[model samples]
Target chain A: MSEEIKEILEGLPFWEHLEKEERELLERESRKVFYPAGASVYSGARECLGEIFIQKGILRTYLLSDEGKEVSMYRLRQGDACVLTASCILPAITFDVEIEAQTDVEALLIPVGTLSKITKKNVYAENFVYKEAAKRFSDVVEALQQIMFLSLTQRVAAFLLDESAKNHSQLISVTHEELARQIGSAREAVSRILKQMAKKGYITLTRGEVKLENKEEMYKLLN
Target chain B: MSEEIKEILEGLPFWEHLEKEERELLERESRKVFYPAGASVYSGARECLGEIFIQKGILRTYLLSDEGKEVSMYRLRQGDACVLTASCILPAITFDVEIEAQTDVEALLIPVGTLSKITKKNVYAENFVYKEAAKRFSDVVEALQQIMFLSLTQRVAAFLLDESAKNHSQLISVTHEELARQIGSAREAVSRILKQMAKKGYITLTRGEVKLENKEEMYKLLN
Candidate 1:
């Protein structure tokens, strides 16, 4: 298990830069964890969960409302790290959020204690965590700007473009419900918007796929 | 000038916790900066402005759209410190945000070099920046959730409650335009909603003040 963990850690971007002592501490202390699809990974008001380094699958961070509405904040892909759960050492987190496994996830968690000690001792580790946390902060700011300042149509266009670019395919395979979940909207609302876009010949929506028919025009919509 | 700065530094929450060395470095390097209302303090694609510790007035952080729309992200008030401007050390900031002075602002600016040196040598200073940055992250997440998940009515109600509590008064002094700016809405929309709330007896809208008549009922609307 330790050997496997070592291999996994070595695959991470931050691992190579970690000093010898820091690497030793993590090799001794890091634990592999798993979450099935749709599992609630982190909820607010819990014990510190330290930092998570994803080895497989997607981990989503979002906020839930009293009415059961979920607004997606950002996602962690394989090789990504999240410092949000390490709230024990970060007392400035004043709000609660829900994190879930969008797909079955395998991750290595550095416990708060170990992570704390390493950050205290290593400036690079501290900078790494601070940078990771700031990335999420930037994502949240962008999401807020989109929702509050832009139209839902623009958001839909940007989402489709983002998906297409991310997957490196003109034909994006995603259901209306899934897109709605990612964009924080009603499924019906997303479908209606897509249908209108399809009518306008910007995209072709067939079943669960959105094929970009006018990619340039769609890209122009974002700017 | 040095004595006045020392007096001002003694008033901050983080100043007391800073060690003698950290305090000396800051006192020697920090400078008082002022901005008039409507001044743009930080924009993306610039040199690191270091972190600003507010001495007086309000500094607003927001995102601007090409269509001239402005969405407020968060605000920093008196006695607060912001680590976000020190992007020289935080390369993980991937998005650009505009920071403006909402009021004629006076603040203590810690140059990026001094901040970098202090955090590298002082664990407490590092943690202090981490905590302050996390507070802004938490605020951004909350703002995103509010914009994407909740209704405008609930947001207006909650805003009134927050202002009332912040000012420790039943009556809140703010214009519709100012309220719209804070809530990331339009003046017409805010006025329309305020009129409806006034008609419902939840609030009384004077020219520049919102008197919370049924404060309990307004508070319950948030949940």
Candidate 2:
């Protein structure tokens, strides 16, 4: 594999221990694709779904409820794989969720058929992919715990803290409605809470963005 | 390879396609252990916990809150595998939850070390373990979705429905307090709701039990 490709695989838990030849084979199989912000990668009724890896930028996985409410399942940042990894292994039907580029994004799109063929022929490939799935599953479990135990305000606070850790930014660039969808609440409820938090100097809200004014205070409120 | 062991493997997703020889080898490695009702398998303070598959009887997983409130995480009935598989692999300094047998139980306990060795030596074992983890993760995600989307009454109704499906019984052999713990609500609140439900002819409550009087009505109320 090229040095450039090797570096990318190094950070990925599954590919870290791959042999040079095996790494090269996988690199050969993978192809890069890009989508602009707000562009839909795949919708519920679309075909041509496959394994997608976030090479750069952010994306959100969401489903439309029967009532036309948007339910945000998760957000995938740079270097993270899509939440629907298992869907790639068993491609029997179209998925309900739509994968949209939250920002101008680049991804490695590996065809499901090609992936299955590689895994069948290579034990290393199968182990790597399954292990990656296991990690994703663990992450999903943690997300579940949060949704069950945390309130709407707490969930948003947790999200802010998580994003701050990732981007080191006090400011979070998301609208109240988007944040409400992520936390599984009404936009009015979110707006009301944000106003309260801002009044107490816990956060600063202006237009569509929010900035953490007192991290310690916000942390206390969350806990 | 014995036919008896091969038959048992067919019941589990992990060992589905194994050759007779491989099945026998796995059976040889597995050890059946027994625990009486109320026996603790592993406390939240323990480490290096292995996988426990309930061959018979039941087990309960729970965590105690700071205020000494015990929250029931899950109940593992006969044939249910311990869902906290990743904790063993990741090796936490202390266990995250306590597992206690709720009845005289027979279990197949697979040591983490032995499983690790098997995974390194055999492709089937590795795939099986990862697949099981993936399934458990999915269950956890579903639980999270329920917690986020369902109301308190809906959750209780859904829990009853889920229990009925599992046991084929309208009578769930658990207390209102226990139900509250699982649902993360107060015991008094659960009791009040049960009384209201009973008055509405949706359910019947007695000492240490709650029975569905009208499942269709309960389902309607849940919706």
Candidate 3:
């Protein structure tokens, strides 16, 4: 188990810069955990779930509104580390966001204090944390711009194109309800837009799936 | 002039953590620049301006849509450092947002390489950068939630209440167009909502200004 943990640490770019003592400290302190799909990993303002480094699968982070609406923020995939869940390091900020497993997942959890100690001693780890935070910050800003400036139809179209590229297919297997949650709109509104797109020959929609009928037309909607 | 710059640097929380040699290096390398109100500080994705530490006045960072609609992201005030403008350090991320002076501003510019070197060598500097980045990320996420889940009326009401608190008075001197931009809405839509709030006895509207008549009523709209 110790050898396995050391091997994983050695594979990470940031861990390469650490001294042998620091690497050994992290290997000894960090623990691996797993979650099934649909499991709640962390929630609320005060829970500090440590710094999570995803070893496999997907994690979805989102916000819940008083009206019971869910707005997807962003997702963490393999090799991505989430520092926001460890709010004890950021006492001035609140962590009201919820993190859930989108697939059966494995991750290494570094206790907040241990991560802080490693960062204090290792410049590479510190730089990695700042860069990741900045990247996530840019992602949130991009999402805000889309929500505020893009019309619902434009957003839906853009989302479809993005998902298609990620899946490497013209056909996307997502329900209208899931699509609506992804774009922070109502299911009825998403369904209406998809139906209109289908009528316009931009896409073809069926139960629990949508396929691009004309990729060129769909890309044009992005602008 | 050098003495004045040193005093400003000493006043900053991050500077205190630096070694004396690092502080002297910063004093020698940093340049102070001024921006008149309404002057553009930074724009476009290709321009990486370096780390900006605000010495005085306000800077508004916002996004511009293809149709020229403006959406306010956040603002930087005295003693605040903006890493968004220092995109060279975060090369994987794009800084497409525009930053403009909301008031006549004085700031210190540490060239990207210098700031990067300092952060790499100093644990305190790295921690400070990570903390600030995390805080800004949290701010962007909060704004995203508001735009996605809150109604325009509710947002306007919340904005009025927030402005009143910031100014420490019920009367806020801002044009409807400015308020509209702040909340990423149309001037006409903001005016209509303000008119409704005035009629409902929650606020009083005048040319270029708004007065909160019932703070309690405005707070109720937040829920």
Q: Write the per-residue lDDT of candidate 1 for residues A111-199, one digit (tens) a residue.
A: 99998998777655765677678778878877777776667888999998887886689998789998898878889998999999999
Q: After superposition, how far is residue A47 of candidate 3 from its true place, in Å?
A: 2.4
Lowest-sum lDDT 10-residue window in model 3 chain B: B86-95
Every model's DockQ? 0.56, 0.30, 0.55
In model 2, the runs with Cα more than 4 Å from the true position are A1-29, A42-48, A62-65, A68-73, A83-98, A151-153, A220-223, B1-29, B43-45, B62-74, B83-86, B90-98, B220-223
- DockQ order, best first, reads 1, 3, 2
Order of candidate numbers by TM-score, starting with the best: 3, 1, 2
Interface RMSD for each candidate model? 2.6, 5.1, 2.6
Measured with DockQ on alpha carbons, how good is candidate 2? 0.30
Which 10-residue span in candidate 3 chain A carries the lowest summed lDDT?
A86-95
Question: What's the TM-score of each model vs. the native?
Answer: 0.85, 0.81, 0.90
Candidate 3's displacement at residue B4, Å, is 3.6
Model 3 docking tier (incorrect/acceptable/medium/high)? medium
Give the per-residue lDDT of model 2 (tens digit) for A1-223. 4454446655565565556676666678667778999898877555546677787898887656445666566678877776363364632212355678888998777666666766666666665666665565555544555655667778888888887777789988889987888766788998998888899998898888899889998889666
Show the lowest summed lDDT stretch of 10 residues, model 2 chain A.
A86-95
Error of 1 at B193 (Å): 2.0
Off by over 4 Å in 1: A2-4, A7-25, A45-48, A112-127, B7-25, B37-39, B45-48, B112-127
Note the residue pairs that clash in candidate 1. Answer: none
Candidate numbers sorted by lDDT from highest down: 1, 3, 2
